[model samples]
Target: MVTVDHLVKDYGTLRAVDGVSFTINKGDILGFLGPNGAGKSTTMKMITGFLTPTSGTVTVDGLDVSKNPIEVKRQIGYLPESSAAYPEMTVVEFLTYVAEARGIRDPEELNSRLADVIVNCHLDSVKYRAIENLSKGYRQRVGVAQAIIHDPKVLILDEPTDGLDPNQKHEVRKLIQAMSKDKAIVLSTHILEEVEAICNRVIIIDQGKVLVDETPAEFKARIPGASIDEVFRDLTKGSALA
Candidate 1:
């Protein structure tokens, strides 16, 4: 459902993403792994039409991201790294605003979508509380809730379970897995265990380029008797971590 072809992003003289190409089909949950400043977020931004690419192309369901930005964005649900939200708004209020912004004008539809995401993200307890009053984990859930509120065809998540507790992380992973059957997901994360738990495919990028693209099992098979972290370090040892 998503295709990235030779995507490149440059900021002045610095090349953030270089000739990165990948395709994600329905039911594919791609674990986008890289060290600090590895171009993962930059590539995602270009794909989501948040940033213009210096070269190459990104398409969502046959619509070019740059050429048909609004239509393409309509098909994508993006949860950026910061998970920025209005701290003053209550959970329900914030989500309602987002739902309307995404074009859910019908009151019945808006309420139904709101209800679905609240239950799915386990935010029922804090639905009426202001966002600033919630814990980091709960706030993160709110971010996920807003992203899925529109139920877009593609999900691009950065550090999806960043501040969640172990149980909360597991719950989020299960939710991602349950939604994968109908959507193309790009999940960027540092935790290898999270990838092994929920991602069917892994793509490791470094220094603005893709280094390894394969299944998690296949990636581990490359270095037998080694932990995932050990393998990751071995693969990226030469590149300076930003």
Candidate 2:
């Protein structure tokens, strides 16, 4: 449901993302892997229509992200690396604002969506609490709740599990996995175990280019017996100096 073609993003002379291309089909959970500054986030921003690429194209559900940004956005839910919230707003109030902003006018549907996301993301305890008063994990859940509030066909998550404890991480992973049953998900994270647990496919990138795009099992098979960490090191070895 997502396709990126020859995508390139240049910052002056630096090519943050160079000719990176990939496609994610329906119900596929793609694990986007790369070291710091490896263009994973750059590619995601382009796909989500958050950042415009210097060249090439990104399409979501056949809609060109550049040409039809609003339509593309309407079909995709995005959770960036860091959660942005109104510190003073309660969880319910924050979500209400998001729903309104997304033009969700059906009061019944909005209420149902709010309840489902709050329960699914385990935000009931803080449902009435101000966002600034909640812990980091709860705040992250709020961010995710807002993203999926519209029930988009695609979900783009950047570092979704960042800063969470093991239990919280597991819960969030389960949520993502469940959501992927009907929606295409592209998630970028440094956590290999998270990928192994939730992602159906893996795409490893280096220096803004795709190095390996394969199923998780096929990715593991490449090293004959090595762990994902080992495979990653082998693929990215000497890349920094190149």
For each candidate in turn, the TM-score is 0.98, 0.97
Name model 2 segments beyond 4 Å from true: 239-242
Best by lDDT: 1
Question: Clash totals for all models, in order?
Answer: 0, 0
Q: What are the lDDT scores of the predictions, listed in order?
A: 0.94, 0.90
Q: What is candidate 1's CA lDDT for residue 27? A: 98
CA lDDT, candidate 2, residue 172: 92
Give the per-residue lDDT of model 2 (tens digit) for 132-152. Answer: 998888888999999999999
Among all candidates shown, the one with the greatest TM-score: 1
Question: What is the per-residue lDDT of model 1 for residues 30-130, given as tens digits with 9 covering 90 to 100?
Answer: 99998898999999999999999999999999999999999999999999989999999999999999999999989999999999999999999999999
Candidate 1 wrongly placed segments (more than 4 Å):
240-242
| Superposed Cα deviation of residue 26, candidate 2 (Å) | 0.7
